[model samples]
Target: MNRLPRLRGQLFERHEITVEKDIVRARQAVGRAMDGLGAKAIRKTRLVTAASEIFRNGLNYGGGAVALIHCDAGNRMVWVDCIDDGPGIEDMALALRDGYTSGTGLGRGLGGAKRLVDEFDIVSEPGVGTHVRLAGRA
Candidate 1:
């Protein structure tokens, strides 16, 4: 997985990752939650795509992780957090660049996700795991 950004906040919903099929549910849950919270359609679509990439990384490379999606209406924003527990990225810079994937992917996951969100943050440790948080304001 690429170097992911870290974010901290009280997440209202949490989903565990154990198998591949969970990715579909993960994507749906996040999209519905954001929609229920009044997030715009475009925001939901972008975030859904980003969430898919993040979940893919979490399972494929990071082994597994939990997905946290929150809608802060008081703050007029929606955010998603994914935490993985595999060997973290060693080169943060390379992971952020385009066409630099270490796995079989097209290397658009991290960079594309970043572009889709209004705010993006990633934090990882070599021995630990990775934390990625993305947000959008509607």
Candidate 2:
């Protein structure tokens, strides 16, 4: 008879991981969550890709943020919430448009993040903070 491996549940927290050039670390963090949840390779890749971009935006433009990865038996989810007390987006509609980057161009911006994730939520206030939440199940 074959036996299934026992499942493990864990909650992880990463704080103050700068978002500017830490794309590699952000990818690693999301990859860990995907692997821990037993996500297939393809699914894991997609999730990590989307998450890496989101993390970068939060770090580079938004200033910085944190991540919360949660896993349980039979399912896994990653929650990335980036907060920055900087000049928040004055026009969210314009900000979410593709190819709208405050710095550079040539790639889809926040809109790409929204399209790539299973779930996405964002809120911001001028002179306060920008909060972006992205979640995916595997």
Candidate 3:
């Protein structure tokens, strides 16, 4: 139920997530951005993993999605927003819990992503769409 803010900072890359390949591109984009920001290896990996999970969720559950990568030079942070127009989650709390999945996966996408990032926010409206933001320090 936490609302994600509008994408801010310098948007270095934008990718449309319509297929499996797009997810890889998004992850690579994020990784490169983190590298450019001088993020530590663990931090870069965590952020990329978080971004990939959200991208996969958008593609598999949201039907498709888009990833916008942003860099906050002042804060030395990199973040990504993954958005989709699929049916919004009906139970936000339940969805955030581990071991609770609406799909065939292990039910750790959202929660695992959250643990891997420095900042996490998600907003979804039933019948509307879902927006997930993941951020990490560089």
Please report the candidate that would top lDDT against the real structure.
Answer: 3
Model 3 lDDT per residue over 11-126, tens place:
98999999999999999999999999999999999999999999999999999998999999889999899999999999999999999999999999999999999999999999
Better of 1 and 2 by TM-score: 1
Candidate 2 lDDT over residue span 51-132, tens digit each: 7776777777777766544455455666555556667788889888876778886458678878877777788887776777
- Weakest lDDT window of 10 consecutive positions for candidate 2: 1-10
In terms of lDDT, the poorest run of 10 residues in model 1 is 1-10
Model 3 stretches with alpha carbons more than 4 Å out: 1-3
The lDDT per prediction is: 0.83, 0.68, 0.94
- Candidate 2 local distance difference test against the native: 0.68
Candidate closer to the true structure by lDDT (higher is better), 1 or 3:
3
Q: Which parts of model 1 are misplaced by more than 4 Å?
A: 1-10
Cα RMSDs, all models: 2.9, 8.8, 1.5
| Ranked candidates (TM-score, high to low) | 3, 1, 2
